[model samples]
Target: MADLTDRGTEVGPGEFAPWPLLTMHLGGHPLDQAQLQQLLAWELANPERAAAWGITPANGPGQLQERLDWLQALAPRHGDLPLPPAPLEQCLPLYWQLWLPLALTLKQARDELNRPLIQGVLGVQGTGKTTLTLILQHLLEGMGYRAVGLSIDDLYKTYRDRQQLVQADPRLRWRGPPGTHDIDLGLTTLAHIRTAAAGEAVALPRFDKSLHGGQGDRSDPEWVRDVDILLFEGWFLGARPIDPSGFDRAPAPILTEADRQFARDMNAQLATYLPLWDCLDRLMVLCPADYRLSKQWRKAAEHQMKALGKDGMSDAIIDEFVDYFWRALHPELFIDSLKRDGEHVDLVVEIDRDRIPRAIYSPALAMI
Candidate 1:
């Protein structure tokens, strides 16, 4: 597979080198630098900014600095994090500006709920859900919480099951979409974690995308114990179904009559995932500056894979792959709908073309 964290090159206005903020050879401030100073100034300039983001409410003066200091002390251990070649220094600005705040917010949510908090993160291709969960787990661990990351992919139907599914509906040529997951399995695992006692074993389902000729299948369940927080993320995580009629005049990709039917069926399938979404204590979206960028991001990922001398889909294949998902659940309709429904969504982090967060605000607050 390509570098999971690779957001590829430019997608919107302004050019960006592939992951400009990531570096393996780390040398720079871990914290308390220009980025930190700028963030502090931004927060100070407008106290309401924190409230709008739905993070832990800022307390008296210097509380934010105290939080930063606490996070800074834990930053060094992350300096050489090898996943996708990101360094602590290079990621410091994002940490101080976006991620650390999210960690703090998760901690606050955990404190409110006696049971384990299941936080759902929804992001499209290259929005950094994988990296975000890993970093958030680290920061939450620093804050004295046992946080674990789980992907919706893990809940996929066994290969044999999916084979049967494809036979029924040829439209599902791939694993992702709403109907492919074992919703019951997800509900069971979450329920087990929510009520698991200290030191009690909780097994999370794992899926291997490389298995069965890339058809993907369930592997052994990973045993973890006493998880205080679960960061559940996926491409369409937490997406809710829309009215079937919405597909009548659907956008570009859903142009054909067959395409509209597939979309409508997917909208119905989304209803099955609601019980799983109900399992979440909080939901946040890592939205793109433009949903269309996902196509470009997928192509970048494929290009990176080929550069590594690994087999990858051609640009034409990549287009078909991404467009299929968009047809199933277009960001314009489903994800944007989530952004509008503040009652369910807790936070929205708008990521720019460079995979940098440009805005972080609550949906209700954004309306204001």
Candidate 2:
């Protein structure tokens, strides 16, 4: 075993201790004591590195070590405590790449999503909605706010129940749309979180997408969280009614004229949930540049599923499946409603057809 103390020397004034530098890089691995020492040593030798990270040298080695200890303690609780592959110096640029702009936007929108308010984020499939929810939870927690994420998908009806419905209708291929979920159960959970006694534990529903439905395992550890900020995100979260004429401009061709009529019919059916939007304190829309980009993201997600040793649909099949929903939902419903009712739609982050985010919407100037 390598002695961590022998690998690195401390530098900087006694008040600000330099972080260590490591020779052996652990890519995608958790930081061990040896690696941690090396990083400390590198920081000591290059004090300017600390400045770049916004880390002040005012805290001596002991304080720096204490910070590391705190992070280590937080790791297991968060699960899979993996460190960034790049060196601290190299990682700084990546942080600024996304975090800087998002930080500025977040600062402007922070009050809307943080503290005593319920934030609802809505987006179509493959919009990175879940990932953004997790990121928001992490960021909010870091800022000393207690935040939790709950999805409507979790409250899905049981597998057998949903299977029967799908088998009966055939049109209900996916159990993700509004009627497939248990709205009453979801509303109850949210009510509990909002009005329940402090420290109360409530059962939360869990969705098992691999099984195409949910399991009755109510004992999952995520249930009954005591949180200050609750973020509810899902597909069709803020979906509303739209005029039938909006479908005239859709680019994707249907099988026949009747198929086009069916698409318009489905949009009209979702009108029942328009009232749900009033429950949200704020709404943010993650608009991808185009359907093609959304399809690419779906492919990437399928690939990730395969990498995780899970069974997944092929790219072509996934694209076809997503297209069916987009053709029915996007042009006739979501896009038209957002464009028409600008007040309720707080922000629309423009994503290209390739699924790359180009710019964000500014309601003040009405530009992306």
Candidate 3:
């Protein structure tokens, strides 16, 4: 109920109230209202010292009065607005706080733009990769840099084509894995964006979670070229070719008897796509803390989908689907990718199994 404009300066309708300006010691935390008032009272009592500190009697009194008034107004509102349950706020901060360093590094890279740069973000399901990409887009735009987000999921070949692969091998439940996507379309789109041509538009496909197929009408196309940045993000964006020799030793639980055979067959077909990572300017892996955390995050993601009105996906279904890829989803493989390709991948922030920051990986430091 406090009005911001009553003190000579006019505030627009629905404008937020001005916050108080109270400075503490150079390296100290901000002063609370009581401390600020005590300081102001002490300063006013000693005019000679206040003047020596560059506080003129006329303006100093007015500024101190404004600070007192703003504090009085802020108190009631601060008490009225509900604070989040402490635990929720605690975990929530961990979600974004862990990524701040990586975000800062990426922002710095964007600032040093000499040529076009394409940044790819890699994560398994529910690792917040898409959300991170959206956050990056927002931050880049805030910094006066242009960024376009394109998900590999959006380039899945026609629904009809994907369905055939699933039908051909019932083991392939969802059309998300490597061979199921339209690699040709994805590569072509990336090439178009890279070359800086105008009038070239590529229609990106959209997935329909309710029907477990394409939405039929949701396709995003970039008509104009010369885009500064393209954020290509997906579950397996940086997945390397599974060395055939390692397949024999892969855990049996990771692949069912049928899935093991299917993976072997599919890997042969996916050989062509292995070189796609070479085209990336940089690869960023959002490595989960561990398999357990990854699974929990995946389940939480499924619940979020339900809240958003998506159907055909329940916790049970998510659990079952996750089981199929458990064997193939290796954090070690990702770690190796970061080690071998550290130069091409500017930064890797290793999150713990608890989703807390473990260490940061950079080419110069290797591990920080």
Estimate the lDDT of model 1: 0.78
Instruction: List where candidate 2 sits over 4 angstroms from the true fold.
Output: 1-115, 212-221, 253-255, 304-310, 331-333, 352-357, 364-368
Best by lDDT: 1
Q: Regarding TM-score, does 1 or 3 come out ahead?
A: 1
Q: Of the pair 2 and 3, which is ahead by TM-score?
A: 2
Per-model TM-score on C-alpha atoms: 0.86, 0.65, 0.64
**Sort by TM-score, best first: what order?**
1, 2, 3
Cα lDDT tens digits, model 2, 1-368, are 00012112323466332222211121234456655554555554544334323334454344345444433333333332122233333322212222233333343354655434566777777776776677566655654566677786777777777778778767766666555666667767766766656777766567656553333322243765556766788777777767677666655645566656757766776765555567666676766656456677778767888999998889878877877776557643575467445667665555554333445543433532
Residue lDDT tens for model 3, 159-247: 67766777887766566666767777777777767766454454434554435433232344545444667788887776666666555
User: Please, what are the lDDT tens digits per residue for candidate 1 over residues 1-368?
Assistant: 11323233224766333222223112333433444454444564544446654434345235565665665567676754435566455555565557777887788789999779999999998777887888788778877999998999999999999999999988888999989999999999999999998899999999999988888789999999989999999999989989888899999789999999999999999899999999999999998889988888878877888999999899898888888998999888998899888888888888777777667778877677
lDDT of each candidate versus the true structure: 0.78, 0.56, 0.55
TM-score of 1: 0.86
Q: How many clashing residue pairs, candidate 2? A: 29
lDDT of 1 at 275: 94
